[model samples]
Target: MAGPTPDELRSVVDRFPTPPDAEAFGRADELLDGTYSAIAESWYPELRRLATAYAEGDVLRESVLEHVEAVPSFRISEGATPLTRRREALATAAETLDSVAEVSAWYDDLRTLLADSPDSRSLLERLLHDFGYAAAHVLFLGASSPEQVVRRLRWAYRTVGVRIDSVSSEAGTERTTFTCPYRDVAAGRCGKRWVCHEKLDRVDDGYVTYLRERGIDYQRPRGCAESERCHSSVARDGPSQWWPKTPPSAVEREP
Candidate 1:
């Protein structure tokens, strides 16, 4: 799973704090970890089997999905106590959309399982694109301006331990750190490209996708590797630029 969720992140604020049920939040995380493991255990093998079936001919996407199950799904009731159920429902958002490790594992699984199939690389790319697009939707949408992006991302990134420093009229958002937990995960095994392109770029790209949908231009953010803090801009498109033009201090107003 990913880090603490948007709900869990509701407390990950310094400026305007809305402390979540700290106990419930931790419980939700444990539930998610368990459910994720259950999904992998129950479905990964079956999925590999189905991949063989798909290589044979036309397999309905639904057919593949019918066999996949993760807990706390909409179709089923978790029936956790009222207090816990809300948190558990919130945990659903933590599913494997943005997980680089899970994504790469899927890549490996599909490649290994479907190696003998025709145009497998193209097929893999198509699958990955579909998955990535879906993942981006889970990032955010309907943001009104660059400031909205900053406001939302400011708290959301807190789960990953990032702190927003400022956002310029030009849509450049200064950050206390561009580094994420992913950078440290399996540090020795994964290279710079995997950490940056696969893990980090997805976060930037999700915002880019949403901005582009509104016909707003966006320049993806970049962080300084050498400095303690990385300041980057979100710039794109024509003369009419838009961003949350609030001064940095304004970001910390009382909730």
Candidate 2:
């Protein structure tokens, strides 16, 4: 087959599919490894330019690290299919790049410290002498903080999967409407939470309707002024009364 055109290569990389099984994960890994390697090799000059910009100071490194840390981790279930594994791997790579940015920052800090303290610890001096050049090379060439670089990294990390979009409101008559996605409620195993940031005309009716429409299962906020008027408990109400009480069903009528 003829080699893929630049646009074709981008299309393939930009729309990475989420794998569905272990076999798929392996396939995706191979594909990504080959594709990224090729791109990096072909675009060595551009990559070098970015690296030079990043090595100039800490701003780029900090920005790149911040972006990396912001990338979310995929949830994998028991007996996760190849697709899940692939998605997890991509996410992990993105995370690792973020970690690399952090390490780069540490390296920069160490250099600054060494510049100020030439007589620093022997161990520290030895370590810097060992890895300083390598660290500089990575900072300048591997991860740049420009928008284009960051965007490309993000694209490389996305799983080839469906994207979900949701919209919700905060008013209506329903009581409870929010639901928690965390595995352990007591220990707060998950960092997710349903927050009602909307200001409704009526706290109960509008809020309930909003929650119901959104399929959120939640409870009233403790010490809420409108709790007395709400049918749900004023404090510590159950999920049933929370707005957006459950995940929305497409076939079912909107509450």
Candidate 3:
């Protein structure tokens, strides 16, 4: 059996994250400036909470701080460059893509410490749903057609380095055929034991909340672990329950 060549690997690595279709999905440019940071800012705190719950205020909680601090922070500011121009718009998109990569790597860090914990996947899934939920508010804000929803979702996962191949409708519901987010992470964990099929798209919580806002409910018919390709479908709403729980703001604002 031949392994992937350097060029082959580079091609796959380079392919991620083609920008969302602007006409179908709305305000992707809107995401570059504020939405990416807002999502991470929300995500980081909730992740900390989940970790604390897992650590239960023990020494492991202190290790959580060190582990978190190891991942560099991400923030995108409004530079002198105006997004109206093609180049600047592309730059912003590129930066947003980078931000997604940073978030994914941060989750990858958690896999080591939290993988063995029974409650970890559920906590992580809730946080992922919240990430997609926040993203939908901005990325798909003005777009709601079925095609647009699919495009928005593809873009959402692409930002996190997951490639979705196609979206199809069945029984009045839409399903996406895509690679699992854990495909890359699997080699690091499951060798012959193959404990992942049971895991079934822990990262797809984003898909559920993201698509649900668009008025769709879903079913994932195929969850096979032998191959990286997975047929996935979804489920949910945003955080009135506060989507994985956030701390109250220190200051109240004017209406």
- lDDT (CA) for every model shown? 0.39, 0.28, 0.42
In model 1, the worst 10-residue window by lDDT is 241-250
Task: Give the alpha carbon lDDT tens digit for every residue of 141-244 in model 3.
Answer: 77655556556666766776667877777543457887755544455444321223323333344444555657654333254333457665543222221100
* Winner by lDDT: 3
Model 1: residues >4 Å from true position, as ranges? 1-132, 135-139, 165-177, 239-255
Q: What is the lDDT of candidate 2?
A: 0.28
Tens-place lDDT per residue, model 2, 1-255, is 111233433332333222334444345335335333332344333333433433442122222222222222222222222344433444444343332223223333322321212233244333443353333233224332233222322232132221212212333222222222221223232111111111111132222233333343223222222222111211111232100111112112322
C-alpha RMSD of candidate 2: 25.1
Best-to-worst order by TM-score is 1, 3, 2
lDDT of 2 at 149: 28
Q: Whose lDDT is higher: candidate 2's or candidate 3's?
A: 3
- Listed in order, each prediction's TM-score against the native is 0.35, 0.17, 0.34
Instruction: Please tell me which predicted candidate would have the highest TM-score against the true structure.
Output: 1
lDDT of 2 at 3: 19
